[model samples]
Target chain A: MPPFDLKDRAAIAGAGASAYGRRLMRSAIDLAADAIAAALDDAGLARERLDGMIVTFGSPIGADADTLAQVLNLKLRAYNQTWAHGRFTASAIQWAALMVAGGMADYVACLASVSFSGLRRPMMGGAGNSEGAREAGGSHGEDPVFGMTSPGAGAALVARRYFERFGATSAQLAAIPVAFRKHAALNSAAIMREPFSAGDHQASRFVCEPLHLLDYCLINDGAACVIVTSAERARDLRKPPVHIAGMQPLPAGREEFIWAYPGFGVAQQSVFDYDAGAPPVYKMAGVGPRDIDALFTYDAFSILAWMALERFGFCKPGEAAGFTQDGRIELGGALPMNVNGGLLSEAHIMGWNHQVEIVRQLRGECGPRQVAGAEVIQWANAYGDSLIYHR
Target chain B: MAANQDDYAKPRPAISALNRPYWDALRRRELVLQRCGECGMRWYPAAPLCPRCWSRRIEWTPASGRGRVNSWVVFHQSYFRGFDAEIPYNVAEVELEEGPRLLTNLIGVGAGEIRAGMEVEVVFDDAAADLTLAKFRPRRGAA
Candidate 1:
């Protein structure tokens, strides 16, 4: 295997997000079209210029590349859709970049859109009938006869183990949402702008034990999209292009459905396996975590932030709680993590919004939420795809 | 509650040819795992080929029915309607002595008392008529 180098072949020219709220009162296709249009507009490119596109497989109403193409009325030379769930966003950007770099397409649009409120079947619906759900319920093999059906429950299990191993408290985990909420206060598009406190987070209801309601990501209905094109072409565009400095997927051979039961030990072991050295993302990107100016880690749940911090080498094992303590992750703090509030307070666009925030921050477009002199940004999704961006 | 009188119309496993033997053994109150005869590798949730060596020489081997809790979660809400009655139940992952991990519930223990590394043994629950499910309980005389 030759060394991978994606230093500056492609860049993100523009990013756009639709209105995020409880119910958008729009079809998934419409929301996707809205985001794509805004992205094209932001890039000063016409719809006809896009020759390739990527959409989320979980799009509400089963919207795929063809559906989005027809909705946007574009004739594309190449297009694809990803079914990897939340992990596909960064990979989608990478694939789109490769297309542009290889001259397969001049410009490509990577999009993720979902309307949970408008869907007949929500994200976790049809639990008992689906094969995956049945497997989760311990109907097969030696699984527990009744396993957790929600991802939040599984995340809670991981959180409990982390707390037990590290002696971390709920009060420490509460800092994540509190800091993001503070950042959300500056984001006009954020869903939860109310000032958050540790007391408030502790007092919030427990969706699953050890994970408070505030610890979970919001389920607001929205979409976000970004336009990727060759760096040379992007330099001539309307906006400052955010270069794709490095991108890589999660390490292979890890277990799936990690949260439903305990063997979470195996997953943690996989992470610890990399403790002796840097993760593949940093190695592939040719930069360390310290090189990042802003961090936009997937925050589907608050515990994930701590996990990413440790897994990505931002801190040592069991030190995330202390590392993030004292507002280190706040807007003006050392790391400036999830400055757009992330999925916890921002709209849940399946981590696509994080990419948008990274682009905006790298462009110095984020007014109040911008990190001072921010030149490099990094975004990692739940499925382990990590990407670093530079101004 | 009577075993046959409970409202147990929950979702049952869509048993297939590959996994039928495992389910059949569970119905008979015996724990079994698939072992690759060629590579001597054992696994759970039966598949046709060995994941390690891709060998077709597989055999059903009786397990020790003993393991330790790797981790667990207490579901505060039910994802399926059939489980609505069993809210706040415990689900655990057990690593058997035979080197396979199975998802099962921890019985005879409070949700708060469950811990990693706790010793547990397999027990069968007839969740529905003719649909026996395997679960785990704390090992007797073991902490």
Candidate 2:
């Protein structure tokens, strides 16, 4: 029997996005139509050739994969989706790769189309917040009973703990968002590209204390799509195939908190000295943290960036507060991160935007913000899911 | 004085069969957590069995009503209409001595003064006729 590894087994053929804005005034399906069309066009693949789809979020948040297939008039052989969660972006892509690799589908469209504009009420943290309604409480430490609503508040809990445990301050945490915004300034499609300073981050009002308004990701509406197929299929397509070199699925248990790494201890997790110790994704890719040309993450909140850095062993726990500082995570730095402006300034496409950027960056499509000679990039997250890609 | 009792529009716990006993004890002005009779493991938000050992033997026993502030946050935005008046209210995650952490309000202290590891004791807040919530206040001396 031959040894098997998923390394370079699948590849992203093409990527695309719809206009991102606070009030796109378009429906989720409408945004998805553009993204799907654009991705198919980017890959130079006809609409009829697309066979599978995996949507990260559906229904109340965006268009379902089933609906996208119907409305977009796509011929699909397989499709899947998860609930309304931005964290599942990596999960959807991984599944799409598996579907294409296993011959379950030839070309799988992995994407999320979210049009939050013109809603009756805010879906995130106000009275309409549905996260707290879960029976076992929300996954993000959202307990409506104590007014602990919104995903950002849960992140605030983690930020406060990190500050106390690591002697970090809100001023230091500013670097993460600041760097992402700087990257956004280079992109033409980003929504919040004005580029603010740490002082502005400090001056911003605390939506939840210790987490200023800047700390939160924008709630604008938009969509992004990626086309996945086997490495052989991707090579035959238009653009250079960004190979799926490694994959690590999300983790759970008592030690898991959506916002913090284990032992950094937010919820029921026991506090201990967390050691990154070369996690699997790095080993699977046959590369270390140093091999990554640029890094991307689900920056739903600024604190999550630090958590992702520490969780992926980029830096030790309690060290991201410093590791993220002094232009380290910005373009031209040692290890640029979230170079597509991330979810922070790039329309919160539920991390679909980051994936699009990764694909384009690997293809050298990003004009100014592209990492020079970017051959490898990793999408690691605070929630412990990751995917490593290469040109 | 039950301040929250005046207008309890704030979000309340959903008391299901699994967690109703914990809430019932709170309404009785007692703080209790489920202790695994087999493993002696204590926890909050009630489970059918021990999370550690999955023991079917479980009991609701009184907690020490003592804890330390593991973490806390102040809200400048109102997420709930009931909490609108208390715009800058604080939610403190107090780690009870029994080993489970609870999301509760930190009372009798300014949000600015709250700190992780600050000793706290529970205050049974009768928010409404049939509802009581566990809140926390700094422990100045031994109970």
Residue by residue across B109-129, what tens digits does model 1's lDDT show?
A: 998899888999988898776
DockQ of each candidate relative to the true complex = 0.45, 0.78
Candidate 1 residues A1-391, lDDT tens each? 4455678778999899888888777887877888888999999998899889988644444357887777668989988887635656777888898888778889898988877778665454235223244432322122223645556766776787788767899999999999999999999989888887999999998777888889988977788899999899999999988898788765444243332111235322222233515667677667888888889987888988887777667877678899999988997788989999999998788888888888888878889888999988888643456888888
Pick the DockQ winner: 2
Candidate 1: residue pairs that collide: A143-B103, A143-B104, A144-B103, A144-B104, A144-B105, A154-A259, A262-B71
**lDDT per prediction?**
0.77, 0.90
Model 2, C-alpha of B126: deviation from truth (Å): 0.7
Q: What are the TM values for chain B, all candidates?
A: 0.91, 0.92
Q: Please provide, for model 2 over A49-126, each residue's C-alpha lDDT reduced to its tens digit, 9 standing for 90 to 100.
A: 999999988888799999988877888899998998888988888888778767899999999988888577788976
lDDT of 1 at B128: 70
* Per-residue lDDT over B2-72 for candidate 2, one digit per residue giving the tens place of the 0 to 100 score: 67455678877777888888888887899999999998999966788899999999999999999999998
Model 1 regions more than 4 Å off: A1-4, A59-62, A125-145, A254-264, A267-276, B1-7
If scored against the real structure, what TM-score would every candidate get? Answer: 0.92, 0.97
